[model samples]
Target: MKQLLTLSIVLTCLIVVAWSVSPGSTNAAPEWQSYAPPHWILGPIQGADGSEKIVLNNLDQITRAKIPITAFHFDAPDWQSCTGNLQFRYSDAVLDQMRARNIRGLFWVVPLIGLNCPEYQVALANNYFVKDAQNNVIVTDNFTGHGSWIDYDNPAAVAYWRSLLDSLRARVGNVLGGFYTDSVRPDKRNGVVAYGEAYALDLLDYTRTYVPDGDVVFKRYGVNTPSDAWLNQYAHVAYVNDLPTNFSGMKTGIERVFATTPLMPLPYNEFSGFAKAAPDSETYIRRMHWGAFQPVMENVPFGKQPWDPSFTPQVMQVYRYYAMLHRELEPYLHSYDQAAFEDQTPIFRDMDASRYSARLGNEFFVQYVTDYTPAVQIKLPPGVWINYWNEAEVFKGNRTIMYRAPLGKEPILIARGAIIPMRVYSNLTGHGTGKSEYALTVNVYPIDHSTFRYHDTTNGWLTFDVKGPTRRVALCTLGNVPSEPIIYRIASIAKKPDTVTEQNGAVGINTAWGTPLPERNNKKAVGRNASGWYYETNANRLWVKISTLGTDCPAP
Candidate 1:
């Protein structure tokens, strides 16, 4: 009898799990915000010398991508060979330019402070450097001999570093973003893992002390960098100096952040053999696959290489455009305060795109991980929700559908009659609409016993709308031509009882904290006195996110 009861329990559990599957509401949680950047990292990567600079500005300078970014970061500088030295540090005029162009200034601080420069000597003599077990100050040869590290824990070091950061803050103020640390702190005893985590956390505490509250990011990853899986210590925005696969061990690092807080993953193109320091473009472009999934994207084009296929222009442009789109879709998302859950992989490290696009609050907050090929499903909330990326319409009056992302594409859709600033890129709907348009085939399903209907604005046509039969509905490119295939997803908002009752793990869409939006829309559009999301993604998942939706930063 006990054995039979156990079997019955197992079957019941499966049914509950199946019923619990939200085949309607996407994201389902209130905190999963889109991890896309609105700006692009502009850099003048070099070749051997002048005349050979890989000019990147050659592309469409006037045409803006999804989000507009005016910031630029330099990755390489040959001090020894160059006969001239024109400091490009932040200036008052530069800061003004940033405000005018809506750009921020991010100074990449390399770990080249202690090699042989008098700066290192002066700092060390003043007891500003990290010391060894024998009380001797630590010093080592940075690939760049001029590079050296001071004891981050030392007061003198803190003062000096803050002084530098202050200079930037003074100039850029609201626009000055902290791109802290070039590489992980070097260590041997506890090793890089421990050192990286501890060192990064210390830096955060140190920065928050001076700037009190400002945006900070970590760039130029090292072999000693800590796993992002638990980067509550280091800043959420990562200014990577290495390849994306290197982060494979931390597949869900970004998700982990959004599950709790908002974060960005900005990767620098560190591929260039032109310079002895940077790697080649192929390796850099190859990182695009992983980089695209991140909220932010960037590349290091050093040695002054012109933007070309050899420099991975296609990859860079696609990433830049995609990132912008991701950022633009932010306002409609129900993230930061949303309760997000993940099916944690049981293995050591596994590949999982889980789900990207989820429909909630009449909008599609979607995601596209490594595998854009599998047939996926999404749930929708009552009423209408639209895909803003591509002009695809979906409604949840009835059931759900398994939708597919067009090949190598991500579209942002809006509700049929929703007021939006911009229009989707493509509006094609239905079969034989166009062969090159769709990539992944999506099958929509219903739940409310109603019907699921969607329209394509690409050609301004009503693609399909089902009335009764619970049959499979499919949408894809209509051609036989061989094209690279991938997957994109759609989801719906989970339903709740109509009665106003205590609802856990739920966040309202377009919700604001502190004082709500004003009538005339005449408000400081910033997170002011609030910590909505301070400069970068924090290390919290959805549940904790909703509870602390806004910023807690002390007002200046």
Candidate 2:
């Protein structure tokens, strides 16, 4: 018998575990709100000096492949030099191309001024740099040697830095999406309490003025930052410091970052660490496979393409497959993002972080450990779950099961009775759908009733509720039909439906008593055809398709 813990017990343990880093943190849970990041964010991790030609090349290839990406993060020479000198590369043509492709541009910014830059002179004249005990300018040395950090405690200094950012935005034709604020507190020797707070306030205020919907990401600026709780409310995302390319380091970093969930999910990256040694093709793919299931797939184009160049086709194929898979999961991922915003809960969670156990749960867990001599045991909540990768492998919940997971294929489970809405692939440039088509393929596990809300940037909030063979899908703002011929492909069902009927505010479908598919066996149960409904007796699964365009609705 497996050791079973109640929901309250699990939550209480999570709170206690989370208390290690964030002591005296409030227990007041906030209401969950919806949050969806821009479709994709691409950045170059290694080459900060990347030119427009390089960006254009990537954009062209990604476009041809129809890989979904919405925003580009500019670093190094494109925005500033590694030496902290102002470079600000890129031209009108660059901005125009990004605009044509419907991709927004962003770059890195820090609160440090190079001693040799013209900005330093202006700050020196106006006393904008942080002062020492003797009222002398305090200088710090970093990768970009001998620079003065922003003295945001002074009002005049804040205005000067804000104006500098304003000028950059104007220079870029205002096409930039947002910024990745770097090391707000690069040095702590000054002992300034408002170091990160000052920059965060200005950035948030600027976002509200210009791009209200844009995201602001920060490093070393939030509750995760020791002795700091300032930027937690303003920033949208945070990433752990760069770690080694080895598996243990990556695992430890993930645990640490996800453990500090003051708000939002931590975006995982392996490019920086991997770029140093440029690991073999197998290692690269493994690293990427680990990232594919995370909350946000931060595809930083830093190192050489993960796969060996000799096998370019294979590399591209695998990369494109995972990218598209991530694209296909937007509807599900964004729903959890919203839940995090309003409720202060993270969807990409760990079942137990303090003990360094691999068990993770947020309706599902992905196994990263390769060795399974004794088989990896996972503790699941009380319910039935179907393996997302292999629907045939179903687990009765409230128990621990030792299961072996194969490489490159992580086991993700969908709870029974859960209604997940998915948009079938239309194209890559426009995020799966090429046109304004309201078509969805909803996978319904064996369940009594379940409701899911689809939030689209253009379509707004659409609530979809499914009960048995009946489904209710409606746009919150519009009473009439949002799209013609709305289709629902219900999969992994237990009943065979013969006919489907349309009606006002609802639709009904009945199963047929057809023979199971020929391939239906004990473990592997069902496969559906487009012709009609099909049933698999051994696996107890059925598949059905329903349409609502030409079918007539009866009188209310």
Best by lDDT: 2
Off by more than 4 A, model 2 = 1-49, 76-78, 81-87, 144-146, 184-193, 220-228, 265-275, 307-315, 354-363, 370-381, 400-407, 426-441, 453-463, 469-486, 493-496, 511-556
As a whole number from 0 to 100, the lDDT of residue 372 in candidate 2 is 26
TM-score of each: 0.47, 0.74
Q: Whole-model Cα lDDT per candidate? A: 0.33, 0.51
> Given candidate 1, what's the lDDT at residue 262?
25
Clashes of 1: 96
lDDT of 1 by residue, 391-431 (tens): 33554533456666443344333444332111112222211
